[model samples]
Target: MDRGHVDAPEGLLRIEDCLDADGNVVLPAGVTLISLIDRNIANVGDTVAYRYLDYSRSAQPAVFELTWTQLGERLRAIAAHVQRSAARGDRVAILAPQGLDYITGFFAAIKAGTIAVPLFAPELPGHAERLDTALGDSQPALVLTTAAAADSVRGFLAKLPSARQPRLLVIDDIPDSSGADFVETVVDVDDVSHLQYTSGSTRPPAGVEITHRAVGTNLIQMILSIDLLDRNTHGVSWLPLYHDMGLSMIGFPTVYGGHSTLLSPTAFIRRPQRWIRALSDASRDGHVITAAPNFAYEWTAARGVPDAGDDIDLSNVVMIIGSEPVSADAITTFSEAFAPHGLPPTAFKPSYGIAEATLFVATIAPTAQPTVIRLDREQLAQGIAQEAGEGADAVTQVSCGQVARSLWAVIADPATGGELPDGRIGEIWLHGNNVGRGYWGQPQESRRVFGAKLTHRRSEGSHAVGVPADGVWLRTGDLGFYRGGELYVAGRLADIVVLDGRTLYPHDIEQTAADSSSLVRRGYVAAFTVPANQMPGATTQDTTEQLVVIAERAAGTSRSDPATAIAAIRSAVFRRHGVEAADVRLLPAGGIPRTTSGKLARRACRAEYLSDALRLR
Candidate 1:
């Protein structure tokens, strides 16, 4: 009932800030990929750009602060190094975790007009094959790694033949090589900025070309959507920098917004409580605006039960939940569980976005706190978002905040591609400047999501996208509906179930299991559909009956089997959403396939589940 527009962003923070006094955005004729973020932040001058957390055990080790001035110099140094050691267009692969040097390496690659590839170190196991493939495909000029992870890369490189190997550049374990002479370099917008590998939750990853426009557009929209312009905002995130969301939200936002950003990987993992605690630590000065998936909230929520109000304080947290289906129960649990510690329910920000659009697509305002709609399962999966009556089962309404400043979204029929009316469930299509260029090597795949073309009409201007048919609309392949000027996500359409003729979104069952303590981690459940007809012995009844959930048993809980987990999950889903989940697997940690960024790799997990190679203990 209470709806109000968030105050309009003032000057300096606007995307136009990248422009000069005359209003020219880029630096004329040719702007290199690397200098885009760095130069813009530098134009503002001496502003605290990035704050790196130094957890070195050395007695003298302390937190290192880098400003726009230092960042410029660091970039220059790396650019100079690029000129001596590698070719301009050659790819420079970052083989490490997220940290100060990672940002420095990324900017340096862009500054020198070289394409950079950020590979998550832990995900290397998943990419062993892709690493081999990338080595042959791109023939990277150099591989950069931190001191700790350098050996791992070295060992992997050792496995490859010397002819196909890339030179290694260790930041922490640097040899006698110098990296501070080549400062002068030229770059263009069309030039490739970096190469992004596919999510790679399954087989080896494939390289995707990420141009400067794609990366820049993502950062521009993220800054605007999250209100990063507010001078007081201090970005804090546990997201891994190797991933798009992690790199853009935590790294790019700092450069674009001209605010101090704190980076802490250990503090976040060792004690998830530290995310809120860190904000609490910084609260006396100004609040911290941070982000993470809904799972983080669930992690902290469990802490509330044990710790209660003993030392938790989340007054300074504005946790933006996304990168997966947003959970309403997780929001309520996080909000209510932290109330005793001064955290308001509104601090929970449910959002929607994907890597193709950069990172953020739409973000809600801080006005109504968080709103969750308890909707009927049948009506929702049938492409409708009807609000169930008090007696009807419903989903929590922690809506992903309203459309970000300049973005547009529509729910469209998956097959016909026609826009659906409000309250109708369908794949949500997003149209905006934030949309990425396309996949790197898979033009056909790119055309699949981005389509061959799209057409759009708005005050900003109408335009065509892709070829003839790939116009203004960008199909997100996500199941959701738009109503009352806000977007509500149901789940992925491919992950839906049409058991016994009634449609069901995977999220409906996922949420039902999450609401119950009997299930594993709030996100321990992964829903996917495999063709039952594949079985030579199966019939039409089995073929049409798709959907088998792979639910990781909550740590330490007994009742370990697909039968128990399935029955419990089904009965609950049947009671709540009026649908039945065919299978609910209870596996240990890391049993389910998750993308390097930790998203559920339902498709891959399903393949593994059917292979019988994946066993449930």
Candidate 2:
């Protein structure tokens, strides 16, 4: 915890500013999140801490604001009730819709000194299994929900085994006056503050054990990285609060005493214009900062921003595009579409992060345009990142930006564990105070993923500043490379498809397949590999792997023939990547598996395909 004798990055805050030698949060003066909240209350209590845009019952949005003092009072009151049913270090799950109550419940669990598990409501469609799996894995001692959802929540809990059901508390029922009876609990920076569950795109959802130290350090790191330390930097987000990027959007504003406007993910999906309108409103007060995935940007640019008209002002907005691979085309399209509405050329920020790192790792500079590089497709497949020559087979990649101040990221060979030089794609291993402790309740897997070490490398560009003294590193399971001080994320290591000694990125294949036919849902395609023996007409000697394509037909596409779409996809895959699709399955809309955050769960889809569980058209 001491992190002794390390050189701090120039113009960047030290990690020790939040974590002391004893690993206890530097409190009262306001380094940690709780202390910052308390400090904001003491200094600017009347300032708005949160603004919830509610659209639960009507098309018109009803906005509600909570000042620091009001937020503190409500959270403390709910925390008092939570403490009655849960103990310190115990898991307290928040199973509620996104709104004021959900935000209050999350802070209430933390205020009660319990490990907060932010989860979605059971009523959310297509995620019942995920909810059950998370509940079973965390085994929370208490569950928090709103009065409006109590009955449905109770019925959902009743379906679980008696031992797995946690005591449920309606957060809306708690009176603000009950804050008087609450007792404060002293928490160390090393204490586990929350359990951030992974999206489970490749495997089951595993809760990342985020300590108070990691959270505080990551908040500071992000604040510095994005130049959001200004008091007037406001936040607007329609991302789900349960997700890591979404949580960071809220945390960043709260820690820095800036106002944050939030709405449900469903609201944004229903009408992305809401997010655009929120940005316009937030920018009037100060510089607006927001974050979203690549697809959201594409959808909003194509649908929402085009309809925003002349009155919207986007001059002071800084939007962070992440959570999935950043698409250069999306950035260009979005920027061009919004430029007439006072959007700045440098507004688009491409970043790379994970839940294990408490959200932020690297982001584009505030005044720089989103960078894109074209790599030779063949060289990229061979694990190199050299720029492609003119008229060559090129793959465009967006730069994820430089590493944060206090973090050290090294690209190391996944097999040899040796650090790779610049322009070589490899697993991204990270070391920083911002890294979480590990996965909750799984020691072996935790150690395997979080306790990595770099093989001693004597070459240049291997050793870097901010390396942990313990020599431990976090294996991100993501494949990327460092080029000219910026990180270029290639793809996921597990999601890589290998055939004939050439590696293929599933996203590229999926994109190609989607573009082949208008009836295919663009973002709903999944491309994976299956053993040749698993497919029909495969002899025992055919031990190689074959490519499989699964795509969803767009809704209301009865006029478009499914066979034609399938034929186009097969043709496109063969033309683009020189690989014949051994099997192409056409399904109805929403057939592909997706994580809670709307990411394509490729591994899960492959399993379902193998099991013949897909609802093929």
Candidate 3:
């Protein structure tokens, strides 16, 4: 297989070979992000990567994101300690919220070349079981956590086997003579970077192994996509770092002369306008780049663009839309709402990617105006992306852009494993340097995903060096089509709801309600199958499938008045998805279980629903 190279139209993406036909890139035994940042800081002294309003200090303080030199000092301290304490290559677990400390601890683990396992930071209503399962699956030797979060996971650890228990390494600022290993600073990237566990609802959370080389490659891909490194653009982000986007999306952009504004999803969801205000209030004069899922835009559209407290302009903001499937209406709604504040319609960059692909595979270039197609909703919901034109009630399909300059995207028949043609909805497959190594330790499933490689048109001749062996591809579980050199997403093949010969993706239905009138207005609603038998080990949401909607009221609106919200959502779902909601419950804003990185935890939300958590008070 040929190692592919990125040849972006702009001179921004020049590369010196980006492929390894041998299927393995030689990497140091146990590298970490600490090493990378440390090297950068040591080499380039006094370069700021983050600046923020220290509410406690009540002034803008320039936090050192990295100055190569400072990074070296910190990582050196942490790496030396970890390397000295290797007990059969002990795994270190990070069970803390997002902060500088979290980043440091993670980098320390990487510098030690120790496997870093990140537990989802969100409070899963019934996550103890999942956490216990993950702990057992990874069988870590040590765990690093904050005080409060450590308190929460303490009891959960007791449920594990005595021989398999992990040694707790807490990063305590408020110390009480607790005798746990405390990581002060991470120093290297030659270690196993991290083991990001998938959110396990239907299946167990698989750990995806990452290395220093892999992480570096992924970060470079992100920089090229957004041009953050070129001409020195700045970034403002609210994405959580635990997920791929948080790790790569915001941080990588901030690595080279780019600054980042960090906020938790809960923070942004609580005040949809904060994201806008972040961009408007930036002190720097560079193209502001950032990203959020479709729901974020819907939330802003619902809350109504906040009055720019200080003549805030978002026209220069290049907001990337990805994570979940991108919806045309949600982007349009947000673009129109914030347009008055100088929010450019082109700034709504609709793109496609996932965690398996390291959070970014393709993006609608830095200045390329977001291209959207109006398509037939009925046809689309049924796996046919017949394009429609500008009109009332027409479904807007946004292009996710072509494959990332370093990545390859292919639409294939789910059953036949054969590549499909443009405009024909099928499973979206990916292959490239950006593709992550298979899930950690779960070799069987990993082979099923990353190991099952495939060839594309580019692989036919000289490009054949990189085509996956055995006609395999990254099973995106997403349904989409290619047209006019751009990608238009239909729905997720994995989450499709096939009813009475008609097909629909749960996200599509959710997007419709999120985009349309205020029924769901800035809220969360989902549809899942509830089997008629509710039998143990029952798979698929078919035959016994039921739509369950869990939503948060708009900001400032109390959940106590959920009657109106529920009614609106119920009516909208019925009208659009043709699937009646089994029940609609209004949860407090931010109540929905989300991924560590702030993605709506639909399965977790569904679990809450089935347990009467979706009921009105």
Candidate 4:
């Protein structure tokens, strides 16, 4: 395997430059994650590697701390145990919560030369279906979890068929052993590292086959893009370990030789202030860097500033917002609410990424403020991003940022498979080493999604420009446009609804409805399109598709007057999006389906609605 080297553009620091006078690269190229951990132990053994906290236990919220030396020893011991049953290339499922144990088990799987499948613990109701499906798909040789979750994991696994059952191992019960005697295994850069499962928002979840090369390259891209090298960077996160964002945060900091603090997702949700407080504390030492989805910023902003008088300091913090649609209003609200607490507007970094691209594709420059544009709604419906004056016809969009210097992006017409001009909304196509190999056990899908090529064609007053015929591009399935050298994501191609020859994005309609009524639950609404024939009060001549919205009602809200709620939703959709929903279903809280990453499962919700399975009021 080749230890790929990145040719950093002028004025940018190179990864190899982070070496000593002896020309020893701090993080050697082609090195596995285990090697990174060992190097950290050798260099900074006494430094804290991870700190896990559980706010549920008010008496003792601080759970545990692991130093570099201790973490290396623990992971090696777990690796030895795993190697006894699993061989190189075998899959090992990790059904653990967000804690130090999950991190140890995951790295240990890598050290044991087995593919790690990180999954959510079966503590939540209705998560068994998802767990069972993942187990049947991956067919792991063994499962690893913490002592606290081992019983729940076993109970869920008992219901599975005998053929699909996997051996269970508890990390906390593993006896301590000297890892120095353990034999180290060789792992190649091109070898499979793990299977990152998709969110399954629009379809059934499939495993994305990610290689060590992709992981290493993406980490380099992110580190360089954010200019974290030689900087005082402290990592903090509240995202679940199962998601790509969370996994990258934990793993990337280790590779960078930095300390990270983690908190449970439930704790963060229960008290958003804890996340802010963690950042404030970390800022006392150095600049704090953390990442979360867009909804987290909204949730924290909604909590309002505490009355404790400017106790929090966000001046030395860089908050990355990604993993979902970037809301301009959310960014504005968060910045304004925290400004009194010393939060700078430029600290909020809006980014764009996906599981297929390993993790990060692009992020705004650290010194620049995030770009938010208001475009004409009518022009946007026609696949153009013309600027609109201040009025109700303007649609606000936040730019994900410029493409990483190591990667390339092109906007392509989905229908024609040809590249589109800048500022035109179309499918996003990416090309870079960070892109994953393909989906696991899915040859057809891999080829179609990862091996896409551009088709050259001539049009009026334009000559055909041929792209390299041998180069393969990753079809991102996301619709966006380029403006001023930055990417602005419009919406997903699969979630676009067409009505009366006009294109409408579900996010726009859902946002409008959520803001229309206080009773409707924010971020819990889903919008999709159904055939005109399937909707009542529509004639056969109505060739246009009908809009359908299913929104969850806030808890403790009265459902006795469904008619009024339905009318309000309809009015909001028409007033904002210029289209009326053919049907509006107001369901109780938790009625709408969401993926493990907290993304709206529009396709699943649509399926349930069509089957009359949704609990409608």
- lDDT of each residue in 185-279, candidate 2, tens digit only: 87677888899999999888999999887898788778767877566788999889899988887787566566789999989988888888889
Over 4 Å off in model 1, which ranges? 1-47, 54-62, 122-139, 160-164, 173-180, 198-208, 252-267, 304-313, 452-470, 514-519, 533-542, 558-566, 574-582
The clash tally of candidate 4 reads 0
Clashes of each: 35, 0, 37, 0
Report the number of backbone clashes for model 3: 37
lDDT of 1 by residue, 17-106 (tens): 444574323322343345545454546546667766544454222566667676767766666666667887888888776677887777
Name the candidate that leads on lDDT: 2
Please report, in order, the local distance difference test score of every candidate based on alpha carbons: 0.64, 0.84, 0.61, 0.80
Global fold similarity of model 4 (TM-score): 0.91
Q: On residues 1-617, what C-alpha lDDT tens digit does candidate 3 reach at each position? A: 11133232222122323324543332333333454354345444466554432222323333335443444454455555555555534677776765555665666666565777766443545456666666778887777766657766666666677897766655544232221333444434433567766645334567777655557666666666665544345667767666666666444632343346666555566676666777776523556677777777877787747764757767557788885467666777887887778876568778776767666767777668878677777887666778665563456667877665556677777777766667778877877655667787778888887755543343332222455455456776667888876777776565677764677677666665555435343536555655534523445554665666566655566634567667777787778767777656666656677654445667766666566555432
Better of 1 and 3 by TM-score: 1
Task: Report residue 450 deviation for candidate 1 (angstroms).
Answer: 2.2
lDDT of 3: 0.61
**Higher-lDDT candidate of 1 and 3:** 1
lDDT of 4 by residue, 1-617 (tens): 11133243232234665444753223345666666677778876777889888776793477689998889889888988898878899999899988999999998998889999988789955456677777788899999998999999999889988998889999888866746545688877778788888888876777888887778778877877776664357788998888898889887666656778999888888888888888888887777889977678878888635557648878778888885568887788889888888787778889999899988888898789988888898889999988998665888899888776557778889988887877789898888777889987889999999998878432531112323566788998899988887888888899998888899888888888888888887777999998876554456765567789998887668656767778999998997877878889888877998778777889888877767678542
TM-score for each model: 0.84, 0.93, 0.80, 0.91
Model 1 worst lDDT run, 10 consecutive residues: 458-467
Candidate 3 error regions (>4 Å): 1-35, 50-66, 87-89, 120-130, 146-161, 172-191, 199-204, 249-259, 266-274, 281-283, 300-316, 389-393, 453-472, 511-519, 533-592, 611-613
Pairwise TM-score winner, candidates 1 and 4: 4
Cα deviation of 159, candidate 2, in Å: 1.2
List per-candidate RMSD values in Å: 5.1, 4.9, 6.5, 5.2
lDDT preference between candidates 1 and 2, better one: 2
